[model samples]
Target: MNFLVFVKQVPDTETKIQIAGDGKSIVEDGVNFIVSPYDEIAIEEALLQKEALGGEITVATMGPNRGEAALRTALAMGCDKAVHLEDDAFEGADSYATAKALAAVVKKLNPDLIFLGKQGVGTDNTQVGQMVAEMAGLGHIGMCVKLEIDGDKIRGEREIEGGRETIEVSLPAVVVAQKGLNEPRYPALRGIMQAKRKPIEKLTVADLGLSADEVGAAGSKTEFARLEMPPAREAGKKLEVEPEVAAKEIVAFLKNEAKAL
Candidate 1:
């Protein structure tokens, strides 16, 4: 069995986001970037599968040159290979365009199983994995919390609106990992040193047989009209009155000021 995991680089969740001058992007300067937390879970799941099934794991990502750092981190966590899908044309790509590029690689690699995060942190569109599965003409299971591989099929337990559902899909399918899938492992000192020596393969739009207009901003189906900071929240009012009075005041605020009733 061969495993391919897709990872994404995102702004650190703790980093303060600032709208760029163009109002369609963020200011990258002085901001720390990390692998999307969900993607980290996907990588760990791939490693676990490789350990039990006896195969090589290849981790891939589509982003700027900086995205190689995410691949290196995956490699340091015991993945056997890394691929960086980088091109200037990939800039400003939406989930649709991004999935097209990723699906192309999936087709070329023809891995037995593919893994991806259920959603990227910054955008949270939750569309790329299913799109890639569609474009690749493969079965997909999303939001999987438990996965068991049996004979040429996999059984997965996934979360739903208020409960869990079980699904079974054959090999050569895509699995989108949700939180609670597994705890991600940190890169060890020995593995980190090994990662420094491993080479990362790079691919481009042209290499994937994709035209410039079929990906990136030109291929994006949606556009951001404007971007701005959210309004500041008002400080809460503390009540020192009697319990009954406080309850009455809270109800009044909710009905009249909050308008949530």
Candidate 2:
């Protein structure tokens, strides 16, 4: 079995984000980057699969030069190799273009199984995995919480609105991993040292036979018309009256101010 895990670098969840002067992107300064939390789960699941099936795992990602850090993190997590898709032309790529580029790379690698996070934490767009599967002409299972491989087929349990659904797909499929699939392991000191020496192949749009007009902002099907921060939360009100009075006040507040009665 050959496993390919798609990882992404994103701003740390705790980081405060600020809109850039361009009004379309976030300011990169003072931002702490890490592998997307969900992607870590994907990588962990891929590692589990590799351990059971006795095959190699490759981690792939697309970003600027700084994105290499995410790949190295995956390597330290035990992926056998890494691929970095970096190019100025890839800047400001939307989900469709990202999926297209990833599909192209998947074609080149032709792994038996492809794994990715259900969504990128930075964009929160839950579209790439399904789009990549469509572009690659492969079956897709999203929000997968548990996965099992038997013979040439994959059995997975995916989360749904109220419960979970079981799915079976043939080999050469794409799976979008959700949280609770497995706990990601911290990279060992020895593994980190080994990762420093692992080979990382870098590629550009031209190398993938894709044109600038077919990716990046040019190929984006949607555009951000405006960017704004969420409204500030209002301070909470406190009741100082007796318990019975406070209960009445709460009801009145809910009915009038909150309108949630």
Alpha-carbon lDDT of model 1: 0.93
* lDDT of each residue in 88-191, candidate 2, tens digit only: 99888899989989999999999999999999897899999999999999998899999999999999999999999999999899999999889999999999
Off by over 4 Å in 1: 241-245, 251-261
Q: Which lDDT tens digits does candidate 1 get at residues 27-61?
A: 99998999999999999999999889899898999
User: How much RMSD separates candidate 1 from the native structure?
Assistant: 1.6
Kindly state the number of residue pairs that clash in model 1. Answer: 0
Error of model 2, residue 215, in angstroms: 1.0
Clashes per candidate, residues 3 or more apart or on different chains: 0, 0
lDDT of each: 0.93, 0.93
Q: Give me the candidate number with maximum TM-score.
A: 2
Off by over 4 Å in 2: 240-246
